[model samples]
Target chain A: MIAKQTNQKAWFMVLPVFLVVAFSAVIPLMTVVNYSVQDTFGNNVFTWVGMDWFKDLIHSERFHAAFLKQLMFSGIILLIEVPLGIMIALAMPKKGWGVPVCLISMALPLLIPWNVVGTIWQIFGRVDIGLLGHSLASLGFDYNYTQDPIAAWITLIIMDVWHWTSLVVLLCYAGLCSIPEAYYQAAKIDGASRWSVFRYIQLPKMQRVLLIAILLRFMDSFMIYTEPFVITGGGPGNSTTFMSIDLVKLAIGQFDLGPAAAMSLVYFLVILLLCWVFYTVMSNIGEESSNGGK
Target chain B: MNFNWMAWTAPTASFFGIIFCLLVIMTIWELKCPGGGPRIGILRFETTRGDRLFVSLLGSAFIHIFWLALFPGLSLYWALVFSCIYALAVFRWV
Candidate 1:
């Protein structure tokens, strides 16, 4: 697949993307790094703090708890959404009128704003007015997200699943759609079982898209803020608070800029590391499979 | 049996209702025009009409959500405006 000519002109085409990333990502990231190493006390006063913020953050119980909670949230979501999305994509109508119908319906949940998603679920899960809350209450379950940590976690998880599972479904559907008809025909000719067809044909073809889906979902969920902020406000006693929420409370709420900035860098590094690991592992598996097929 | 028309007035319910209506319209449109050849867009990937619609809808949702979150006291009319623009751009270019 290597190009016959090594052309440098391609860099010109990439300049816009590079510029946008520089301004939007790199500048703010540098500002965070600056803030992470300095102490500020109003009136434009500051003091150099070195790695003190990072040191304190590393030993902080709150940070550890939030980190663990964040991990758990992402873990649970990937577990539920990936398989669930694939199954839904599998069941989706493949042709004619059903294609658009299935796509539009599946895409509907994803279109709502994050906060609006929170608002919708907030109202939807209220004991007095929310349909879910009312039904659960009528069903004789003690489900109060406002007062119970377990209930709050469940609500947040369900809200996220409702909000994001569509992304996975859409990615998987695109992957499924891209699969050639010849594969199906060949499987039919060979008398392959349904599971075997999925395993050998569909799964292999979907590997690339699934990798993208997992990475996107992982990063988004790890940095999730607004929806949970709107729905539970990181409460029932900080039960649903993840790292981003904690960072915001530290930086904005208490104005602990140094520690918050340090935490942010750490958070960014963790995500980068994990995504790199995922990419390496998945691509290795892909290469191995292709080699084996040869 | 009497239907609950009042239930349809809620924002969430109305959102779902609008989605249902859109699905019906899209279904009819698909039935009328049965095929959509893939077109390459800005992403340099070939996408059919359904893929374009998915991207547009998803983009619109994010636009609206960000609007709501960033500007709490303001009305959603601006968000709607931005969303429409986004949808148009996505359909045309992506």
Candidate 2:
């Protein structure tokens, strides 16, 4: 047996990282907290307002609408992306020269910068000069994302699906690839049906990655800003105004610092709570299943 | 030294101060008694002391926010009391 040496120098090693995180995250967060509870005029003059901002935000009809719309967008995105990703992953080549080609193509969308993605989609959805818009117009389908709420939403959703479904596909592919050949061999020897093999073997194997995929997708879609912002600019009306877009409008456009700060805290807290719940439940399920296996 | 940009307010400062103090206390406690093992509670999920603390703090934030929203004219002291009780219950069982 070996005794581990305790070195106080480890604290010194950790100091740089601690300082970096404190400066980047903690300071900004403290500032946000300060702003949330205080009303401010332009010259950095501030007055304490206590919980007024939070109260107003919670009761605001505008806030409620944006939140509900955000929820629906994320819900629709997940409902589309996850299953589509899994199906794509299943259909992809397992080996040989085709694997690299498929992988590269899948990775391309993810590599594009977020703002660039937004710009691309913006231009891509324009009725005057865009392929998609022109094609739809030529086909006699009434589709103008600039004017129509449903068209705006469908374009945004489809753009997100195109951009991010690859992530889910890649994660699921890794999960699928990890399944040992012996499991398939065993299933084959037993004359197990394809559906049964997938249901019992593949699904369970993908659970961990699926948890990661869902959490990432949920958080990303929940806080989505760039693509939708560029494409629709929160609308012909306020129809596409997701929470983040509305927050930006309040904070930047209206310069309502107190309310915006309060809204930011609430938004952050919602994400934190939901992520915590998702992580705990999924990990518990994993633990129970592993225990049963043992 | 030059933290004027942060626009520090008393309430927010104290909030961070208390959180910092809680973290330090938890660290000391962990040093004194190692291994805060996961325990399944009423929630039917495994959580350690740190997890319980996180959950309590998060729950307290919601309670305070909700209290402000629902009881606009009321003092926040009652909300603090409720949060304290919530924390105690969480530490005891969850």
Candidate 3:
């Protein structure tokens, strides 16, 4: 291999990106940290309260409820979306005109803006004029997201599944496409059953993308705000209020900057920790497989 | 730079300063040592020095948060001690 010359000028190119990130992300994050520890009485007058807000947020029953509901929401979506996405990907046409059709349709939901998705579902699930709600109501199902907690939860879950499952499908399809034809030919030569081929061949190849899908879905679902906010408005007595919605309520509605900032920090940390764990565990599994089950 | 909009308190500024210092130190260490290659430790996963440092920092944050939650009356210095030990363990094993 040829030795490459070092280029000191590379830093100049990176400087622009570094500056942008510092301005956008680091500054806002510093502001949040600033708010987390201090009390304000309007007029930008602030008093240092140390970790009091964090302590209160840690023990707050409201926070606890939102957290549990957030966990449940994330868990439910992951459980549904991953397998559903895999199945859709596997069923997707591998070649010809069907490929573009499948790809375009799968990409459609993801291209929709989040709030538009929320609005789409809001109207779609309304019993008064919407198709789903009207059909369910006509079919004697008693489904009203605006009024019932269970209905609201179902609406939000379905909306999330519809919107995000495409992302998983796309990732899985890419993973599936990367598998060489030789592997499938060898499997066919061995007289492998469909289930065996899927279990031994398709699954192992899709593992990396599945990890990405799960992590993305997990993070997005955990921090869900717009859809539930638009659909249910976290109403029916805060039954559908997840942590982000609750944080927004605290920060904007009540203007409790200290506790809200504390909650935001904790929320950010929790997501970071969970994503780290998922990445570690999934990568470890990938390594074990690559090491021939050792 | 006029930074009044941030409402930066002394402690928060110091906290950010410490984080910035840590990042600088890490960068300097990387430049000096060159390769902080991945090593498998008690966590049974390959992690470089940078990864271990991240884990330790995140773990320390959790320790302080938990300490505040479980023992609100106690001084945070104990949590600091625990976090140091945790960081040491991560560096040594994870």
> TM-scores of the models, in the given order?
0.73, 0.97, 0.96
Q: Which candidate is the best by DockQ?
A: 3
Global lDDT of each candidate: 0.83, 0.93, 0.93
Estimate, for each residue in A1-294, the C-alpha lDDT of model 2 and write its tens digit. Answer: 999988899899999999999999988988999999999987888889988899899999999999999999999999999999999998999999999999999999999999999899888888889988988998889999999999999999999999999999999999999999999999999999989988888988898999999999999999999998999999979999999999999999999999999999999999999999888888888788778777
Ranking by TM-score: 2, 3, 1
| Residue pairs with clashing backbones, model 3 | none
Model 2 Cα RMSD, Å? 1.4
Error of 1 at A231 (Å): 0.6
Tens digits of per-residue lDDT, candidate 3, B2-87, equal 88879998888888888889889989998988788679898777899999999999999999999998999999999999999999
Candidate 1 chain B weakest lDDT stretch, 10 residues: B3-12
Stronger candidate by lDDT (1 vs 3): 3
Relative to the unseen true structure, what is the C-alpha lDDT of residue A184 in candidate 3, on a scale of 0 to 100?
95
Listing candidates in order, what is each one's chain A TM-score? 0.95, 0.96, 0.96
Model 1 clashing-pair count: 2
